[model samples]
Structures are given as structure tokens and as C-alpha cells.
Target: MAMSRNLTLLFYVTLLLIVLTTNQAESLSSQLSQPQSQSGHSMYGATQGSLNPQACGPRCTMRCSATAYKKPCLFFCNKCCAKCLCVPPGTFGNKQLCPCYNNWKTKRGGPKCP
Candidate 1:
């Protein structure tokens, strides 16, 4: 009788573990399938005024570098100047350091300067 009780207990424990694992996997799958929000937009890295001609430019031909991690503006200043402008994630073009090409700049390995 004791052997039968031990077997039943083990069986119940195994079933509980399986159920827990299955539920965990389902939760993970659902989370992965859900869409992410970017700048209050429903697409990755998309924002309002992203396609505005005035913000981008009338005839801007500036292209982003292949290795640039952030989105490049369509009208960034060329490398010949000391001060340039950068387009922040959620807003339009904003003034920034010339050669750095980022909204924030760093000096001597310190924190970024806005």
C-alpha cells in the first residue's frame, strides 16, 4: 500500500511540472508575438514626422552610413563643418555638434553633452 501511495504522489508531481512548463512556454510565445512600440508608434523605430518633407528636406540626398546604428537624417551637413544637426528619435531635426553627427556629444570619455 505504501508503494502505491509513493507512485501516485510521484505521478501527480510529474503532471504538475508538465503543466507549469507548458504554461510558461505559452506565455513566452505570446510575449514574443506581440508587437513592440517605438516613440508611441506601433512599428520599430517609427515616429511622427518621419516622412515629413519639411523636416527631411525638399531635395535631400544625404544617406546614412551602412554602419550607423541610429537613423540618419536626409539632410545632415557634410563633413566640412564644425557644427551640424541631428534628428532625435521622436522629434524632427535638432541642432548638435558639427562633426559628431549625434544629438549628444562626449568629451574625454565623460557623459554625453546635450
Candidate 2:
């Protein structure tokens, strides 16, 4: 009887964890889908509806703007943007804004995206 009770408790705990994880994942998905502003205007001054391949230049430029190293920063930022189709807002941090851009890793196991 004790063993059965333990098993039931473990099962409930696992199910609770799964439900919590699913809710968190859904919340994150919604946040990632929505733009920073109600108007869909990004911090980079472009509307989400207007973003395109050609617009990567300005976005990447803005992302790499405050970096001490300009050339390499722009290079990698643009490359990541080209492939990921998005750039995290601001000069640094806020990587969670772009999952593809943020999840990329370098050969050395460091962050590949700026």
C-alpha cells in the first residue's frame, strides 16, 4: 500500500510538471509571436509586417551599433540575421526575443549570435 501511494504521488508530480511546462511554453510562444508594441513596431523602428530580407541590413546594423568591435560584430550579426530572419532588439542582451538567433552556438560552444 505504501509503495502504491508513492507511485501515485510520483505520477501526479510528473503530470503537474508537464502541465506547468506546457503552460510556460505556450506563454513564451505568444510573447515571441507578438511585437514589442501594440502597433507591431519593433525597437529597431520597423513594423513586424514590413520586415524582409532587404531590411536585415538596418536591423543588424542597429544590433551591432554599440559593440566595441564593429566589423566582426556586423559580420556575424548579419549572417545570423540572414539565416534566422530576426535580430534581437537593442545593442546587447534581450536574446530571448529571437530564439533562432539566440540559440545559435559557436564552434567553441559560445553564443554564435551577437
Candidate 3:
């Protein structure tokens, strides 16, 4: 009888552990699936990010390297990357990889992502 009682207690403990584990996993996965907000960059304006933001600095630096207008190029490239979360390959063309970067324009209808 005592062994049976111990077994039942162990079973309840195991079930509780399983329930807690499942709930924690579900919570983590839901957080992962949810989009996170970016803060402290309103000066660049609001745009949707579709790629890993951690990679933006290197990608933007590469994109802006060849330009004589490094400051504005870096600024805009980082801005576009923050919004589109993508940067075209190489220091030149290949904007086709990111349509958001490719199609964004200036106030007078110039390419905004450059």
C-alpha cells in the first residue's frame, strides 16, 4: 500500500513537470513567432524589418564602401536595412534581392535605399 501511494505521488509530480514544461515551451515559441519592435530610430522613420537586424552594420558598410558619399550612404543604407532588413549584394547593383530596398524612392522620385 505504501509503495502504491509513493508511485501515485511520483506520477503526479511527473505530470506537473510535463505540464509546466509544455507551457514554457509554448510561451517561448509564441514569443519567437511574434514580431519585436525597434526603438530609438524614429529619425530614420518607421519601416518594417524582414531580416536579422544584427547583420545590418556589416551589410550596410559593405554596400556603402564604394561611394564617395560615405556618410549619407551609410546613413541611408542602415536606414533601408532597418526597414527592409536586407542589403543588396556587392558594393553596386543587385538590388533585385530586396524589392523593398530596390523600390524605395526619395521626395523627388530618386532611389532612397542607396
Number of the top candidate by TM-score?
2
State which candidate, 2 or 3, has the greater lDDT: 2
Report the Cα lDDT for residue 79, model 2.
87
RMSD each, Å: 12.2, 9.9, 10.1
Give the winner by lDDT.
2
lDDT per residue, candidate 1, 1-114, as tens digits? 999999999999999999999999998776555444654432321222233334333212233332242223332322211132222332323323212434334466632412
Error of 2 at 109 (Å): 0.7
Q: lDDT of each prediction vs. the true structure? A: 0.39, 0.78, 0.77
| Model 1, position 82: C-alpha lDDT score | 18
1-114 in candidate 2: lDDT tens per residue? 999999999999999999999999998887576666766555453333335678788888888888899899999988887787777778898887677787899999999988
Model 2, residue 8: displacement in angstroms?
A: 55
Which is better, 1 or 3, measured by lDDT? 3
Q: Between which residue pairs do clashes occur in model 1?
A: 82-98, 83-98, 84-98
Off by over 4 Å in 2: 1-33, 41-50
Indicate the residue-level lDDT of 75 in model 3: 94
What lDDT is reached at residue 76 by model 2? 93
